[model samples]
Target: MTGPVLYGIPNCDTVKRALAWLEDRGIEHRFHDFKKGGVPADRMDYWIAALGWEALLNRQGTTWRKLDDAVKAGVTDAASARAAMTAHVSLIRRPVVEWPSGEITVGFTHDSFKQHTREALM
Candidate 1:
């Protein structure tokens, strides 16, 4: 089977760390750089359905912090969240992993990733 698709900004520190972790474990993945390629609104909507707006949006990032108050206030809904994510790609959480089997996960932790990889490999 093909590897998972890992979406995030290449230069993001968290994404770098996640990539390194995956490499160390010999987990195959394809990287999609949000800054260069841009995320589609439809894909964002799908993720939102699976992960919810709160999980998909990276509120801790500088891009989120710099968002206009109006935009911030409007981000409660999927449409508004998609707009925000489109306007500031960095606000979408880093290292969003979509497995070949159609499982979608956000962010990365070594332990959680290991479990997911084990399940996927099985």
Candidate 2:
């Protein structure tokens, strides 16, 4: 929001790679550690609106996989996903990045980061 904000657990491999990628490029950003602070409610709303809850939700993650079948089946929409993600921060996809230009990306890829950085600098 203020600069670029990267949100995820510090121990996640993807998060670590993303942090390294940003650092390698010297892209100044802020990291929000979900483990300690948890996801911000306001940002959750914004993320849902921007990318849809489907994009933000990580179905493949062990956290989601370990969830009860009932819980998995209950996530029918944004609100439901938000509830799950709120209760389990790990359910949200890794390294959700909020670019300064009001753009948001769920996961990191070198190409996407490159393009986003270019757009941000513009």
Candidate 3:
């Protein structure tokens, strides 16, 4: 309730770890499931502005690999990359965190989350 909102698939191991880490630290956060709710385009736009589409887009995932070479090849800039990610939401890297301090991050790390949360509550 007081911490950042965490977005990702429920089954992702990284998402599980991120949630566990927050729990262990007594950080209350809202979890948004991409599978059921889908990623909001405005949120994606914010992420693209903050971290860039390159980082937000998970090119290493099965989703990305399954994309046609042409689609993958077309992601040369933020707009194109966002289009690709929009078409395949699963191509987003797991655990995109929208910190309460108004910062948006693409992936998860316990230390990083802890630091950001602490700063936000300060």
Model 1 residue runs over 4 Å out of place are: none
lDDT tens digits by residue: candidate 2, 1-122: 44579999999999999999989989899999999998999999999998899999999989988999999999999999999999999999989998998888888899988898898788
lDDT of 2: 0.91
Q: What is the C-alpha RMSD of each candidate to the true structure, in Å?
A: 1.4, 1.2, 1.5
TM-score (C-alpha) between model 3 and the true structure: 0.90
- Residue 21 lDDT, candidate 2, scale 0-100: 92
Range of the 10 consecutive residues with the lowest summed lDDT in candidate 1: 112-121
Instruction: Name the best candidate (by lDDT).
Output: 2
Question: Model 2, which residues run further than 4 Å from truth?
Answer: none
Q: Tens digits of per-residue lDDT for model 1 on 7-57?
A: 998888888988998888788888988888899767788898998888888
Q: All candidates' TM-scores? A: 0.91, 0.94, 0.90
Model 1: residue 78 alpha-carbon error in angstroms:
1.1
Candidate topping TM-score? 2
Clashing pairs in 1: none
Model 3, 15-107: lDDT tens digits are: 999998888878888999988998888888888888877788898889988888998889899999888877787888988988877888767
